[model samples]
Target: MPVREFSSSVPLWAKRIASAIYVERRRAGLTQAALASRAGVRQATVSQAENDPRSMRLDTLEKILASLDLTLASARRPH
Candidate 1:
């Protein structure tokens, strides 16, 4: 499936992170359980992060991203 862009309205960081992870995971053709195992986290944690990232910890997010060969980055928003 083609990756969908997140709209500007979804401004929350957690939501953005979750959307990114979900997309990358799909692109890599990996299941949630497989990602969880690769990231050394519980399957439920993967599900929760995908469904509600606000509840996820930063370290856990980092680990998940690392497992997918992804990294978190930030840039200043245009004024």
Candidate 2:
């Protein structure tokens, strides 16, 4: 069987993920700096991931989501 590649598009998913992260961070009363510290990533990295998740690696996204107490399963669903 041939290996198949998934679409590289993120579209609204990135926005939604970004929104969720932003909301959670706010709810936790954390600034971007604090969130970055907790996640052990640069503030800019968080900004980019939140701003454009499409350009991020799955592992990095997973880490960020994990830091926010979320999971990829929650970010995706059956059509």
lDDT per residue, candidate 1, 1-79, as tens digits?
A: 5544544555566566777778778889999999999999999998877666665688998898888777766211110
TM-score of each: 0.74, 0.75
In model 1, the worst 10-residue window by lDDT is 70-79
Candidate 2, 17-60: lDDT as tens digits: 76666666777888888888888888987887656677788888
Lowest-lDDT window of 10 residues in candidate 2?
Answer: 1-10
Candidate 1's TM-score: 0.74
Clash number for model 1?
0
Provide the overall lDDT of each model, using Cα atoms, as 2-decimal numbers. 0.74, 0.70
| lDDT (C-alpha) at residue 38 in model 2 | 87
lDDT of 2 at 10: 50
lDDT of 2 at 66: 87
